[model samples]
Target: MAFQQGLSGLNSSSKALDVISNNVANASTVGFKNSGTVFADAYASSLTGAVSKIQIGIGSAVQAVRQAFTQGNVTTTSNPLDMAINGNGFFEIELQNGGYALSRNGQFDINKEGYIVTSLGDRLMGYQAIDPVSGDVYAPATASVDTFRPLIVPASGVGAIETSEISLNLNLSADAEVIPTPAPPAAAIDPSDPLTYTYSTGIPIFDSLGKEHTLSFYFVRRSDVVDTTTAPPTYSEWDAYTVVDNDTSTLTHNSTIGFDGVGRVAAVTPHVTAGVTPPTNGSVFSALLGTDAVNPNVSTLGLNAITQFGGESKPRELKQDGAPPGEISGLSISRNGIIQARYSNGDTKDVGIVNLTTVRNNNGLSPIGNNYWVETPESGGFARGTPGNGMNGVISAGQVEESNVDLTQELVQMIIQQRNYQANAQSIRTQDQILQTLVNLR
Candidate 1:
């Protein structure tokens, strides 16, 4: 009986040592959780066989090996492939062979087929991204595949030079001084002539093929015929502005804009070019400016940051309802985990939202190797939602969650388990000695 109990004690201590060693070995693994070995004493019962509370010898057995749920520290890395979960959630991945797996490790990679799959080639699942124009999922309806590659927006598409709107600002200084008018039927004028004052600027415009066309705007202040009765303080409200594309001039007259006294531009007349008539109602104008203050449009125009769209599309009635031609200024992560993209055209838009998911029983998930777990009937159904929604926590970019194993704690437990194993071995030795003495006496 003593020998049997001693053997049982040895086996139990061995199992505890195994658990401790495993904990220590995986201390550096990402997302690893340490497990503890539990033990219980086994006893036997008999009916009325001198049953006077006789104490049974030590009979130990391992009861359970439970995982710890303590949180792990997060570290930042430069790799976009590395990911981390801030709180209660796991990333869903699918095997190429059609089975699904779950993991807390967010480290991922792209497959050879341009798919954004895990390092192990498992596909990451997500709500299929929808097309903005067609309102579809982009792929064919018959396709069942749901994973997708990280989308890389082209630097030249609607994002590159989206010409939604255009604005211009200018201050025409009227001196009220008398100037000579051009003679009748005179188209060509001398450059050095005092009668002509040229106002020119280069505006970057896109052609029909999306190629840049530097439209040089020349506003030659053509003098108006003044009556002898009017004094030097009188000035004409109409200012002639010509828009040219090199010597092959597109427009050689004033745009649809009109000016008032005190150098304030009131409205713009739609500009018309060869064989193309400007829309009657779709003309564009800037915010009205007073001489006391400098308008931002004028300031921005001077910096060459403002874009001028020169397309010939029949214009819809102009409004501030659409996006402007914006350049990629920069990007930022929002408080709600949405990516916001800013453009040079003074416009901002939502790019994408970060998502998260949680499970009712993480341990119950089937471990299919490669740090991946699969959903099973025992593991309750998945709860899918956005981050910061319900039990799901907010997202933190550029950070990764480390393994939960505590090295100091594991080392301490290792020492205790080692001592316990030695004691168990001594018990076995003592038991053998006692049996040897009994045999010697016999």
Candidate 2:
């Protein structure tokens, strides 16, 4: 009878309608994928191989409801924590149930525990800044792919680094008059007297305690040698002195810088001073610099780049390696999934690297609500990679992915399923009328 076929049609159509309704409802959901219902024809036949063309189908059955994993439209958001994928791959997140899942939704925030977490409290898994086995966050180590950890922001600020090395470039006026060396009963170079030095400038330095201090350089013309071999006499020879905080008593005869003495500075040789001097082209200063303030790094001064020219004396550049402690100011993410923490002291460092995972079959994933999916055997083995690597997609910071569901297509499908339901009902009614006619004839 037609009753069985009509009833089967009604059941399959109802299931398809439900699927269409769900797609329409979640059109605005972020990272939501749309699913479609697939129906297969059902038929009854004997094992002896009945006539293929003569056989008629009995009904339709729901075969599968597969979710599409196509890329969605990316839109910018105000939150820096929001992220979107441009091509393929999912973010790996850990659940409280002792298992892990993959997700496309990138809405995340830092919890009070300093872990990056989603709205459902699931922690985002990623590669740590330091190796997990080391247990030392300050030490930099290579990240391992075999181990994963929850991304976290350090509670303490970055520690201060004391200055150990300093480099300076300067030019001294060649026309400056030479200072006469004092004899017995006379005091040495006084910083306040103009006759004490030709040019003086101070460079800032950081102590072991992160406190700022000044290291001043005093250039005094010691002697001028006239090169008779040259077309005209050339003047060259200067003594460089170091004083901290303008204290002349804490002086260290740092270097004796001399030029080619041929009108222009052709070559310069800096003989850095120690208790003993190394072999060089010129005389080396042998003053004791082992005092409390200068003992740490007095021998490191090199004036190889210093010059004597007919111009105003001034420092060209000063560079030092040190930084004060900084507090966390903000966080930033790159397209390659590197998370950097910005500090108040103008320092930045990588805190974590987001993990991106992919499967052979996305349709085989089982959705467990909250925009998450779990790996199943049908999905095959998982391949983990970082964002913008291999086949993985690039991440867009401060953005979100819109739902892939097309509302217009879903609405049209809903109308077609509604018509199928009406047709099945009409077929049932026609079958009932035939039975009534047969009973009347009997």
Candidate 3:
């Protein structure tokens, strides 16, 4: 009986060593969790056998082997193909037969059909739920599970061009010389005009047909000073005009400037040149303001000097409603997982948000091929939502998570398992020797 018990002990220990070795072997495998084996002591029931002087202890038997799903360290790699889970979640995958699968391996590839697929050519699964209100799939109900696809650039899209936001950083020096203000003194030029200021704005605009056009804005300041104090001064108010023209049809805005009580230019009105018409070919295109007037309605008087002019010809200002060309320049990712694209036409629009998922029982997942796992009934269904939602992790761009294996820990476990194997072998040898002695005595 002692020999039998010792042999069982040796067998159980050997199983434990096998479990440890497997853990060590997969130490570098991505999303791999180390497993541990549990052992249970074996015993004979007294009711089943005749009573004995001493009830000898029995050896151990291998019980269960469980996996550990602790968090892994996230590392960055140049290839956007490499991905990692930041927090409590696994990427859900769809099997070839329509059964759902899950995995922590984020490495992905694009398929021939333009579908974002796993390297194994499995089409990524995304949610396409029906909308409650309309009783149909909501707008853009599908979401891609794989993230390693290249961003697609759209050739064109709907919606009219708008100049909602404009920022300017420019210089209007006092030493600026004028281009001999266009004919007839566009309102008798101000005599006090110390110097004339000139500036230009270049706008790359596009026609309604998507043809590229360049609209250059030129500003020639007649005079900055407006002496409304002179009781409707003899000269028309000194005004700033913006001329819009490309290589084609010349269009001019020579709108006159309105003055207040202090001879200061107040509001401005822009008008296209008498013979020329506003470009109907381009979409809401470019509008450039080169004059010192920072605000559309207000003009500087004291800090910036101008002459007080009164006459028939007034300076023409560019209409604020002109159309400009648009170009996609770059993209950005927000903390909330929203991705946005920037346009060269000085416009920004929202594109899409990132989705993330988590599981209730990660350890219960079944390990499938290609480093992926399939969800079993034991593992609760996915807790799906956007990134940073609930227990999900924050979304990071241009970064990925790395395998969590620690070489030092594996080496130590290796040593411990080896020692256990040796001890178990010695136990079997001793048991065998004892049995041999009994046989000799017989």
User: What does candidate 1's lDDT look like per residue over 299-355, in tens digits?
Assistant: 111211111122321223212223335565654444334544566755665544444
Candidate 3 lDDT, tens digit per residue, 1-442?
6666767777876787777777667766666766777788877659867756777667778887777777776666564434566777666666667676667666655466544456776654433333356432211333455332222323333233333222222333333333456466363232224243244455443333333344454445454344546544422332343323443233444344444444343454445333333222111112433334221221111112222233322223323222445555655545444545566756665544444557788777887656677777888776766667678776555455555667687678768767766776787788888889999999
Ranking by lDDT: 2, 1, 3
For candidate 3, what is the TM-score?
0.67
TM for candidate 1 is 0.66
Q: Alpha carbon lDDT of residue 331, candidate 3? A: 52
RMSD score of candidate 2 (Å): 5.0
After superposing candidate 1, which stretches have Cα over 4 Å from the reference?
Answer: 1-6, 47-60, 130-162, 169-199, 218-244, 252-355
lDDT of 2 by residue, 131-208 (tens): 468442331244466446887877767766656556667788877888876895875577888777899987766554
Candidate 2, superposed: residue stretches over 4 Å from native = 1-3, 46-52, 129-135, 138-141, 169-202, 218-241, 256-317, 429-442
lDDT for every model? 0.53, 0.76, 0.51
Candidate 2: give the clashing pairs.
none
After superposition on all C-alphas, the RMSD of every candidate to the true structure, in Å, is: 10.1, 5.0, 9.3
